[model samples]
Target: MLNAFHFQQPLWLTALVPLGLLAWWLKRHRHNDNAWQKIIDAPLQALLLTEASGKSQPALLWLLASGWLIATLALANPSWEYQPRPVFQTDTAQVIVLDLSRSMDITDLKPTRLARAKFKVEDILAQQKEGLMGLVVFAGDAFTVTPLTRDNDTLRALLDSLSTQIMPAQGSRADLGLLKAAELFKQAGLHQGQVLLIADGAERKTSVQAAKVLQKQGYTVSVLGVGTPIGGPIPNVRDAQNQPIVVPLQVSTLQQIAKAGGGIYRPLQSDDQDIQDLLTSGKTIQGKQARQSDDLQHQDWKSEGPILVLLLLPLAALAFRRGWLLTLGFVIIPLLQPDPLMASPLDKLWLRPDQQADQALREGNYEQAEQLAQDPLRKGSAAYKRGQFEQAVNEFSQLHNPDAHYNRGNALARLGQYEAAIKAYDEALKQQPDMSDALTNKAKVQALLDQQKQQKNQDNKNKDNNENKKQDGKNQENSSSSENQQKNDQQSGQKNTEPSKNADGQSGEAPQDKNSAADNHTSSSPKDQDSRQAEQKKPASDEKSNNGKEQKKDNQFANANQAMDKNKGQEQPDENEDAIKAPPQSSQPAPENTEPRGDPKRQQAIQEADTLNNEEKLAAEQWLNRIPDDPGGLMRRKFKYQYQQRRQPAGISNQTPW
Candidate 1:
């Protein structure tokens, strides 16, 4: 224990030793001076050399010097080895590299591959005897989560909090993990250390090369495969078939990496044989070394600084002059005085405003916390928690950091401003391109925008369909009205023609009577008979002309009916063609001797047809006006041209001379 003794402040002891010796010498010199002064002043010396004055005094000066030396020793802060219990010692240091890739989330083992690996790590830590252990967690990149430390509890706590989602990138980069572990061991001043890889063995080609380099550097790499050979599908992701995508353990890859590193590879098992093998392997390597140093043992030492301070109390009491007041003052002042080095316990327990504000935030008092927050980022975070997205956006805009921008994007997204949120995410990516959370959110927002666009297009399509249905209904109603009006006109024309046919029959009877009378009277005259024959032939020629005209009128009515039927399905009728086909009504009356024509009925039918055509044309114009202008202006112009053509034909007559 004495050999292990060391001083934390050796300079204090170095300077204090000489000062203590000088103090003792000065006390003796003062005594000698007093004696010489007594001999020089005989009269005064007689008084000074009285019994009280010459009485032998205690060694107060020596006591004071001794106290000074003791105080200096206390200041030196000495420490030494003091073993309270036996400790296991070893010569090796180990680094456990934990893989945090997404593949580790697969449940090939019980609970999950990562969970099992964590349990195994805890067991390994518990079994570790004297060696310093470090932790490294890696995914696409690697980082030293903890340096070489003898504190197992701290390592376990860090391990418990780790998951694949905590990693900023997602992929197996075993090479980087090994490199980080090597660096940690080097920092710990270990020329050779053991590396225990706990992973699913999803490694890249670079992993093998890195393992070889680590082997060259005297690191014994041992792999404990967390997953089984027959793997399971990873959760939260699926293939095109909507089934979970299976991920298998890369046994060959792990074996190759172990070979390259000149290490051992084994699957994790329920038995502790694999862990025992690792410990035995480390011990074997230690035994192969030329000699073991005391430093490798890593003994824990207790500081003797406080013990030295305790020793000063006795020395101080011996140095003090015998006085009740001085003793009381010395004891009371020190006990009453506060320690300047540290705060009081009560003060430490008290909460500060900032701390209270943080507590408020944790308790979900976001508005109150936002008011209390002094930092811009904290205020923004509080505002975000309160669901005040616009306020949060304003606060976060003042900050220029990746996390702030990423959070701002989330707030904007919540407010349904997807485009703005995407821009904010872009800014975050500019600061940290590998921010997976931001990338994932940006993709989600983009998908939402696409969905909104699709919904808008569907709504417009529905609206157009509704307008077309309405137009079809109106067109059907107009065609029915036109058919009814045409039927009424046909009936009226037949009624008017009946009277003309009866009158013609009456005129024929009269002509027959006249011919008979002529025949009887002219029976006696041959000249009279010849004249009557000529009159009969003239009547026959006139009747043939009348029949030809009536047939032409019938053919015209048939053509008009066919045209109406052809246009019945059309939404917009060709009014110009109807006007061109309608014949003009004759105003002049025919001579009585000639065939009497049905002019009045024909005029009435023509007037009614013309009025119906005008009404149809007006309806078409109204429909044209209701249509919206097309983007290209082509559809609007086409409607306008059709409307103009329809209106022009409404003025033309439906009737024409045969």
Candidate 2:
């Protein structure tokens, strides 16, 4: 062990041993200036101070240096080599014989007899250690699926894929399976090997004779019957009546075989005690081969590092009493110690501006953190967290990293600059082709922009609808006013025509009444003439009153017609004024003088979409189409799924507007 000893970290020895020598040199050259100055006169001070001897302990210094040297050697990680000593190992082999006959497919055992047998074999394989195992699968005949080998993986693979379909014929041939297993044992040149027979126990009487032959050849035959005594019918194999042919476990036949073979027989059950017992019995078989020994060289290094550390303990105890050395150690130890609060070892190694910024951020000094962050990525992150999106974008743009670009996109998106955000995300994807967060956020922002566009369009549509309604209302008012004016004009015309008709009637009646009055006056007596004159005076008074009233009516009619015409003219000017002031309705872009309507961001997106590739344009359109009408959330889900499939990079936080 001592001869084999070598240091694992010999480089550390070279580095640390020099430090011990430096400590020795400093101790040896040390001076006591104060003590010498006290003893010297002013004139002789220089000579006395130079020549004076100081209290020195070379032995103590040597001890301290020796302690350091030992500690350094300990750090060098000294160890020794290991040597291999030969020992006896048991040589045991087991051959598992699996029945693949149609009878094994019977389902009296939960799933099927064959399935249960396979499970039991798996359990045995799991428990088996330090042994070579072989597999023998049989139907009408037997064949070795795997030769005796220590490779359990190959064995399990062969066993797992085993089925009756692989067999050439269909029948229970336990005797043939046993013979095949025996052949494997013989090939391996083993005097004793255990044979585990897992089957549904539907075998010929001659199978017992085969077991007896295997027993004679030193094979321990253990039969594990894998079906119920009252078994179920084998699936898909029918009788003449087109009914399933039932097959039961031949427990007595399996027992007879085990008895003849000088081994125990057990029925396979839900509990795997039978397989466990079979494995245990196989372990009991001692190695029949002669024991062999060989000597091999190996590293068996014993650690002497801890022993060196123990040696320093006494040296440190002595050095603790020396005031100057103790003070020096106290100062040096603190300098060597790592910061306990720092999580990253690399951070502890270097005092970077980002680390300081991170600390400031943790302390809630966001502004100071941003100011201190020298790395553009870190500064952008700080600015973003503080809701200074524009500042974040500027800071992030300075860096060429994908994360920076992605973060800038986030910032731009927050500012509602969606087109620019999409461009930023595109840049991020170009930098790191697998930047998934950028893709997801890009899709989200694009969708939001589209939604805004749809909303803007809807708003414009609504505004147009309202304007149409207003115009209709104005038209209806104009039509109503014109009808009222026409009615007034007709009334005035009727008044003028009615006065002429009344005058014609008065002229025609006056001539006839005058002639009749002349004839009556000639035939009347003198007294009658006097009374007629009085009556005529009364009639004249009445006619004058009637004429005055007629004149008053005509004047009033003329005044009414003038007032109606004046009102009609006034209303016509108002209608003309309304028509002149009203804005023209058209399905066209706004004039250059007018401000562009709808969300500016949405318009910008639509404009930017013209510059995008087919895939991107399609994505943009899909996002835009996810309007309020998407009650099924189909568009939203599609966007999410596509983004997820893109597998965007992690690390960035997504806080999209939509």
Candidate 3:
């Protein structure tokens, strides 16, 4: 059947497009007079004959024009299907799970089972131009060594990098490997695929569960057994020393694992016939419905399209020398040249909206500059030197750049609108997951929030402490005033008036005389006096309670000191330490003009500075005599200072300049 693909030029086919004004003139002026009579009217018959020949040339030109027209259409690379029909097919994901266990080292097949398997997989992958392929290795445990992807180059590299040692542990668990492969597909959203298991049957029973999981996840398990039923002894080889060595491997178990995983097992044999049979065996499984499969025969219509054009191109070239050249040029050139307005440099070196925005920023006209930036990047760029996040965000928002979104997030964080900032940052991160600025800003905002929470807690604590202190002070003052009143009452109670004295230096009213009676009473009531003295000491005890409050303050100070010591031991700054540290400042010394010294000490110092934290760097710079303006001198200064700061042990007080 011949198919033309049903393509045709529109009503505007106006082939007259290339003929210009002369064609219009001919059409407007041509007259249909009697040709013989007109020829007779001509001055000479020879002249009339010449004119007829010239008319033939015009016919030839018309033929040439038609050729050019055809050439132009051919250049479009049209394809005509003999019987046009769409092919409907479903694709499958195929994963090759290889066993990288030490057992693969066995030389049952000339080189080894592992080597042969690798070779076979490489060949298969090379042939598989369509569909997805992946690699999994099982040794000790099963894991996906590579994900299913169309890029064979990356897959092959990952495959080549596989070795027995890569697994770390030693055991063949085909079930585990298959399960892993199935899980990989699940994660990658591959619903159906084939699992080609290539291994020496060493881990059948151990990995049965993993294999079952793979089967449940809707994967076809095709086990290619790579060892004999009558297995050979596992190899034992020594390095240089004459020492005993052994490595045991089981191949039989692998076949059983494959069978358990709902797959038919094929034995790996030395003969080529067995290999061929293995490659084509068991396409269908018993008691299970097969999925719609992609046909092995694929049509290369895309490739054939170009070929058709190529074939027509030469014919078009032949027509180029004919009158058809103008017509072809008229048709093809208009289509090939892209609209000039839409053209862009691949590297983006040319001035785009984003670049224009950047230029505006450089010129310091930030407001005007942001209008030039584009989206997903409307926020300008992440490369801000001085935290101009607001301007960056504005420009970036225009471009809709995610980095700009992240930059805006940072700016919001700095402004202390943390929750909103975090949301903005999350938006930024969603657009560009790997944005370090977004990550860093997220961490920073979280840290700030934590610090603010801590500070608020401290403030609340201090407030409570102050309230308690006030209450205690009030209690102390009340107790002191009450004691003074009690003392005054005791003094008033001590002063007493007596009526008369007794004749023997006592009052006459000895029984009635209270002074003589009181003297007798005092001797008998000494315990009462001791009780009074105890009452007097009560206020002093109260005063001692006040002293205890001082001890509590001292304890708080001790705890603070201990915390500092603890921080020093860890060699990492705590939040309080970080708060105390000065903010980053660019006081970097200018480069030195002097040549670098060969001195080891200077070199070590330079290295130290290079690695020093901000605090350490600052400290080191302080130790330098004078930072030089020259690059070399600056390097020496930076290094030596940083080294000294880093090398200093903890407990060395870092006193800041007042």
Candidate 4:
């Protein structure tokens, strides 16, 4: 409906109306012109009629004017003066899931599975319109190459970049691809869109799971199987001195993935024509007559109009004889020149300073070549030979030649500049991409970097731990010293107190009054504080001293007991008897003239009291008080009692005079 209404030039319509009116009027009133020449010579009139005439510039001018008018009308925002229509008949999105595994490298289907799939993708793009399209590639790992988009060109470019070699870890990851495709479909919000999976099913697990998930999400999948049932071995490609390295194709894993993904498994026919047929035959295909209601997109015709005019010049030259105007148009119009600067000369030319350096090195002028090689424009060969790795690095910085970079990397590696070497190699690869020597060298450098980094980290950790340990040891020592000092202070205070009594019925000497004791103890034992401090300072040493002191005391006690026994044995028998028979006396003399030895009873009491300890002395005093002074005359009774006792029995008393 939108195609019906269009803007037109009012001048053209008005001019055409007048011309039509004039033509009608002229046809009714005009008479044929008969010149006098016709009467003079009818033959001349016939000759004029027979002569061929060439086309005029005015007709071509009119044509050009009309074309310009039409173009102007188009630019005036022409639109249908009718109802709006939908651009898409259906709101379904479509996804093309391609298999990019190395197995796709198998040439069983003409070029390869990948090539066939790509052709089919182009066909699918050509067939379908509207909604969105997405590309998914699956190998060892599957990922969306491009999300569902309306742009077909971008999708096709994305497909072009895909290959089995992209993922080195080659295996058919059908399940993973399908699962990811399902996620994509979910993100795309394609409710009824189709999932077109193009893969030779190697692993069905992922594809099946994806299919189920998509079905649950209201998405349908159609599979285009890309490998034969009797699968071809996956080829392993390599470089054998510029020759193609062809390995056998592996089994097709995308087949089951396609089937499990709820897709129709259409075997990949190597022929482009065959693949085209299979893609278009499905119920999903939209025909050329499909009603597509798109907005009246106005293209910028101004640039195109001039270009069209330029294009018509050659045609004009061909059409007209002696077409000087067309020739002049071609000459006068300035043609766009190619941008020479856009392409770098360095791209085509290899200005290898290193190669030049190599020639210098071969000539035995190492130092000169090395110096020259250090120039930014020079190659790295001379620097490498001279063992000037850093200089080589500087030279190769500009060149970016692969072999030069590789040599520079070798030099840097010799100098232990692994990371810098990697950078050089990376640039070299940027210039000469996919150079295995550079790749292997880069990998080696990376590994070295990793090891060096790991070692450095370990060293740092160890250093930190050692520092912490030392700090902890110092802290522990300080804590122990403080504790010992506190213990020493406590011992000093305790030693100042009166000596503690033991169970041996002995009291220690009286502690001096506090003032005196403090002074005396300090003065008498200045070493006491020092000893305590020293003991605290060296507990183990002090412990040995305490043990020695206890041993010495034991020796002294044993010696004293032995001395007493020897003294007893040395005494004569009679002297021993006499000593036993004699009345006891106070060991110390009484205070001068205060008490005499003649007081036998008092003397005995005093002797007994003297033998008692302080506690026992009080009991002895009480016993003395209970005894009477004397019952009779002391001398008479004493003599008679002694004689009678001695005469009565020999063993009864010792009163017999000797």
For candidate 1, the per-residue lDDT at 30 reads 64
Predicted candidate 4 versus true structure: per-residue lDDT over 408-485, tens digit per residue: 777788889888788878778788865767777777677788879755643443343344456556656754675566
TM-score of each: 0.34, 0.41, 0.36, 0.33
Q: Where is model 1 poorest over a 10-residue stretch in terms of lDDT?
A: 583-592
lDDT of 1: 0.68
For residues 482-579, write the lDDT of model 1, one tens digit per residue.
55655565556546543223444553546544654554444334563465445544544544444445435545666765675576545424443433
lDDT score at residue 175, model 4, on the 0-100 scale: 57
Give the lowest summed-lDDT range of ten residues in model 4.
583-592
Instruction: Give lDDT tens digits, candidate 2, residues 326-359.
Output: 7877889999988777467576357677788898
TM-score of 2: 0.41
Using TM-score, give the best candidate's number.
2
Clash count list over all predictions? 6, 12, 44, 27
TM-score of 4: 0.33
Model 2 error, position 555 (Å): 99
User: Could you tell me which 10 consecutive residues in candidate 3 have the lowest summed lDDT?
Assistant: 582-591
